[model samples]
Target: MQYWRKPLDADKIQVPHGEIHIVRDRCKGCGFCVEYCPRDVLELSKQFNIKGYHPPEAVLPEACVHCQLCEMLCPEFAIFVTLREEVETIES
Candidate 1:
């Protein structure tokens, strides 16, 4: 089985279609989520979690493209992403 794959182009991915959820307590301040986020959506928060580690925050909420890099790369299972359904447009 192929275990490695090329990273997607963030510019080609649609934006404003998703959101990320942070499991603060589960995070260990590993920074993988922030580092691998394709759209630079996440950042380390100044505030600490109950574990006394700085969890990542969705700093650029509008830029998120539901690429799931943050969710996949996080060893601590701290963050996850959800994609919004596309709104259909009706032609007049």
Candidate 2:
């Protein structure tokens, strides 16, 4: 999705990034998060958890936008997203 013109504050604006966390044993393999993620950040893992269910894995951890959709949609409350802190370094 490219724009013909970029926003004036584009350089100043910071896009929120997110880090995804999954509770493997708590996941029931419903795949709600994988199916509904807007960024396609999650995928069903081939390995089974303690409960014999394939939990979701963060296949594209960098793509998350901190929307929290995965956390809200998970039936078992197994997934959550946290805002990733950006450390800017000052160049001498």
Which number leads on lDDT? 2
Scored by TM-score, the top model is 2
Q: Candidate 1 residues 52-89, lDDT tens each? A: 99999988986676778888888887788888775222
The models' CA-based lDDT, in order, is 0.76, 0.85
**Backbone N/Cα/C clashes per model:** 0, 0
- Cα error, candidate 1, residue 10 (Å): 15
lDDT of 2 by residue, 1-92 (tens): 23477766666656678889898999999999999999898999999999899999999887788899999999998999999995222220
Instruction: State candidate 2's TM-score.
Output: 0.82
Q: In model 1, state the lDDT of residue 91.
A: 20
Worst ten in a row by lDDT for model 1: 1-10
Supply the global lDDT for candidate 1: 0.76
In model 1, how large is the Cα lDDT of residue 39?
Answer: 75
